[model samples]
Target: MFRVIVRSSISLAAFAAGFPLSAAEAANAAATSEEDSIVVTATRAPLALDEVPSTITVLDKAAIDRSQDIGATELLLRTPGITVSRNGGYGTTTSLRIRGAESDHTVVVIDGVKLNDPAASGGGYNFGHLLVGDMERIEVLRGPQSILWGSQAIGGVVNIVTTIPEKPLEGSFDIEAGSRNTVSARAAIGGRTGPLSWRIGGQSFTTDGISAISPAFGGVERDGYRNRGVTGRAELALASNFSVEVRGYYSKARVNLDSTRADTPDYAFNQEFLGYAGARLDLLDGRFRNRISYSYTATERENYGPLRARPVSLEARGENRRWEYQGNIGLMRGVSAVFGAENERSQFRSRSPDASLARPLPPFANGKAEVTSVYGQISVEPVDGLTINGGVRYDDHDRFGGQTLFAAGGVWRLPTGTILRTNYGEGFKAPTLYQMFSQYGNAALDPEEAHGWEAGIEQHLFGRALTVVATWFDRTTTNQIVYTPDATCNAASTNPLCFEPGSTTVRTAYYLNVARGKAQGIEAAAALTLGALTLDGNYSWIVTEDRSPGGANFDKDLPRRPRHAANASVSYALPFGLDIGAALRWSHKSFDDAPNSIVLDAYTLVDLRAESKLSENVRLFARAENVFDEQYMTAYRYGTLGRAIYAGFRGRF
Candidate 1:
């Protein structure tokens, strides 16, 4: 099946290249070089897209504005090598997987601050509440990036950069209303004065959503969600070669959810705060550059059940603090090095009352864990159009001793506008505090590790008006963490690992480093621009397997990862200051459980969008999601939103 898809995609690319299109028009549209796009996530320093040897995707502010997506997850769904599984509608629990890696294996950063939750299961960042109000760009670097990003980057890294003041004075406002009684509003203002610049933005989103659980499960309530967020940033230039920047973000959300039982009411409130401060300095006549930064993030969640009946509640909190220093130095022409050091600390706490016992239960907590790391990389160009990069890192954990990782890659560009790239890297993820100190935790568990490689080719044709890229990657992971039932202790045993094991109460599970997994995939993408019309598409074919003993899921396909996925989009600029666009997203069937007992059917979604320039500073836009209203599920028993329409207007000054 994978081979067939690849062949078909290649054939289609050839056909599109040969399609009758005016050469004059194509040349006019080819003024921009796709390979010249700048990205900062692949390496600590900014590099052109073509210079990066790994697979990456960048979405700039213009693309974000054109997509008309209010949530970050929605925008990511269109990218290659990405899959998102949401448990419900907007503001519900959402998981993002890259290259078939575990949700927690990927690192998420917003304005240099890590957003992973130490108290959450798997220590992953939840995308449910991440809005797109103040975003400037998003860069996704795929593959093992631990040499630079440290742990939890076994899959890749997602860096979100927010907007900063670029003009003396600038501001914008937007308001939108949509189906299901949804409303959203956003506003931003920013300006620069002398050597100082600052920007501030806020957003509010609310929706009367659909049932989180499918009707077949007896769901009959109208779940709803509300979210508010604010962002601020400031920068100061103290000298000609030195500058300081500070950023802060805060978001709060309230969500109504279906209860475990049909008769009960359930709701949750959550908040997140992120802060960052950094400084940059240049010395030795710009031959040496240095950066130092500090970041802190905090997350809190509260859940209430049956609000009318002495509502029982649970509260949880997580925090992370980090400090880092990085440097770049030029030793000679075409030869440079990048180095960095970082220290991080994490904490988790949770509290809940026992409703049945009518007393406060003991709080679960992990005091703190610390990790220190140092890494360095060198990029050398021995010849024209040929670049090579190699790096290594060492991480010391307060409780787990130390580990080292290495990576190497290179890019070679041919004179014919053809590029060849290859990369190999190693990654490791330390156990989270919850995984190590919780009730079912195991202090003896070792960190998970992965090694991977990728090779790709990119070609530009038709005066660079069309670009095609294809990549193949493979990865193997060892010592993966899994929960297993204790065989030595059964129903009557007093062992903590087997609470009423054989009985109906609940089986106790303990974390174990006993799993091995492998994932391999092919990704193909193409973009074409012809005068006022643009077309883009991508396809992904993945095969993932788990080899874990002591469980029924041995050698089974990973859950929630489909074998095939594809996306296509088209947009056109018409006369009279009008624009129109359409997109299609499709995924093959996937299992919802490790054992493959529960199956999620294949699904396809279509969306349409249109916008008109009402005036030089005012624009009107509208979009329709799930235009065909297909009924399907990405997760078992979770309901998906149906057809929805939204209209909005924007004003800039």
Candidate 2:
């Protein structure tokens, strides 16, 4: 199976390379050169990439389509120092780890709305399942960004922005077919006339997964499912430089699973859903900008089969709703100031209908949490080729009380197009509902906190044909919440769930506040342009160690994260209007469990894409993912998608 995957990957790569990927192709694909890209909100406002003072990755439209054959988790597998873990197959509740950071330490945002589920045990958004249609671009910023984004921003932040049409009409429809009987269709439309504009789209997909393990052994369930919904907009001309706009999206999916062993267990199916709605208003011309937005999202999970067969049978649900208002003023030609305030409410609930028939386990209590915060930042350019930025925030968390954070940074540009930048910041994450009020909850739990800093440089050589960037970052967290064994439980009971508590009948899992850890890493990225050819690559190395007092292994590595990762890709344009692209991804072995016990081996994979213009307004494209067909575990006990092929047609009328 692996050999076939590899051969197909190589053949596709060769085919795409032999053809030409033109500038128009790149534009239609939504890919961009490093030097020409711009990012916003990194410094509390819009800014060019080189001026951000941090390590960031941007995926333009072209890149998103190129990886469409794969799920969200697999698409990011090639990113350096990042790891994705899923239950078993596509659309399963996926989790993302960055630089060895915990799954809950990363924050995600869509159209300026934070997607973190306040009900999560650790205030972070779940990246495992998300809608991918209608996205204009994706920006990933590494390292701590708590000063501006708050809490879960400790590891980094992923911001997904959708495209807004400026014209009177525009739309596209795409249909694709691949292995595993996979089928997919996506459509989007947007337009503007006078002072009104709106956009919307959706996608549906399903497949029988590839075989990595035997079905009789409960390995790799074949038929899985996926679905998505999206809407967006911007309305201007109501008054010069003023507009009111709305943006929102919804998605749901079901996935099949196969355990590696017949007796291990099987959760044949799982499902998920998310919905969001918000509005943004631009006011006071170009001098001052004011924006207000609100969003609500929810998630639920269902496990299939008999009670004894499913050790963890149940229904779990959680939700988060937030409202924010922001203001930015251009104080001077080279200076700007921003201030914002926000309020958020969250809840989590879980129920076990079969606990009576099956072995009973401790249950989590339904709980609520709320937060209010005020933040501000300023940008300054004291001299030519140099910019400085600083910000601070104060939060009153209902569960953990008051917390404050601050950050400062600067960027310097040289005459040769080389630049230097650095930043220092602090962050905090309030304890989750489960930690404070659940069945085995600890009432005295405290918020987690961290301080972080980084330095980086970017250089362009050979007259802008080649670009390079390198960055080093480090962060330390305190008051980390960890669940230790309830020592009172004895070994004599046939059903271990019958263990008694030492001093209380409530039963205790012992939430310890005495935990500390630090993470450090380095990353490099580059892009090169030579004639009709373009090459891009990224590499990252990360290490995290627990250092809490009386810690078990202060020197051991973190779980579920690779110490090293690298990805490289090449694209070329041919004279006959043909375009070809290929990419290689590699990652070192890593552990899955918290104790760093269970291990997964290292693996590499390849992907290829080819496209050609069938006419002035029509085009044909095809892609093959998991080209190497390397069999590897996506999660601790689950199988990943096998080598798959996709062919499609896309065009605008």
TM-score of each: 0.92, 0.87
Global fold similarity of model 1 (TM-score): 0.92
CA deviation > 4 Å runs, candidate 2: 1-37, 210-223, 234-237, 258-284, 306-312, 353-355, 358-364, 490-510
Q: How many residue pairs clash in each candidate?
A: 0, 13
lDDT per residue as tens, model 2, 378-404? 988889879898899999888778888
lDDT of 1 by residue, 398-437 (tens): 9888999999999998989898999999999988877776
RMSD of 1: 7.0
Q: What C-alpha lDDT, on a 0 to 100 scale, does residue 330 get in candidate 2?
A: 83
The clash tally of candidate 1 reads 0
Against the unseen true structure, what C-alpha lDDT does each candidate score? 0.80, 0.65
Q: How much is 579 displaced in model 1, in angstroms?
A: 0.6
